[model samples]
Target: MIEMIEIAPKVLGLRINGKINEEDMEKMLSVCKAKMKDEERIAVYVEVEEIGGISFNALIEDLKFALPNLKRFSKKAVVSDIKWHEPLIKVGDKLFPSIEVRHYNQDQRAEALKWVQE
Candidate 1:
């Protein structure tokens, strides 16, 4: 399941609990694209409960949207229990200098949301 959380202006929040397919990616990209049109840049907060699977089509769509618009993202906060995510985020922070990526434990969801808005 994927749901949008309205946290702040120009900040997009998403909660992902299950498998993500192409349709989910398309829906999210549509909303994000609309937000980008009005705000130019945006921050993101993602709370991941469990990712059962992701379709290859969804991955491709995400890459298409993310590659060219990397600079359009100011910050990203990921909240999950996955241990590897922290190191991955650190690497992402370096690779995408324009976007600051941070990882937070699932218990720190509130803090992640606050930080993403900041």
Candidate 2:
């Protein structure tokens, strides 16, 4: 499951708890795109509760959405306790250089939000 919200004027918050299928991903992207219609850049705070994989179609859809929004994000904070999340996030940093990606442990949710707000 994917829960997405605009925590601030231009800050997007997301919580992923289960497998993210293509339909959910498409909806998430649509919501975000609509929310960001007038804004050139945004900040994101994501918290991962469980280890979930994305569908191939979801990945393709995500890239389609991301391609045009290359420089749309200013900062992104990911909160996850999973060990592999760090390396995965690092890879994301390489894929989307527009945003600065940082990973914090689940215990550091407050800090992560604070960082994203900055």
RMSD of each: 1.3, 1.5
lDDT of 2 by residue, 1-118 (tens): 7888667767878889988889879788877787689677888888899857888999899889878886888989999998988998999999877789999998898898988988
**Which pairs of residues clash in candidate 2, taking residues 3 or more apart in a chain or in different chains?**
none
Off by over 4 Å in 2: none
* Candidate 1 stretches greater than 4 Å from native: none
- lDDT tens string, model 1, 4-88? 8888779988889899999898888888888898998999989888877889999999998899999899999999998877787
Report the lDDT of model 2 for residue 102: 99
How many Å off is the CA of 113 in candidate 2? 0.7
- Model 2 CA lDDT for position 85: 85
**Model 2 — which ten-residue stretch has the worst lDDT?**
1-10
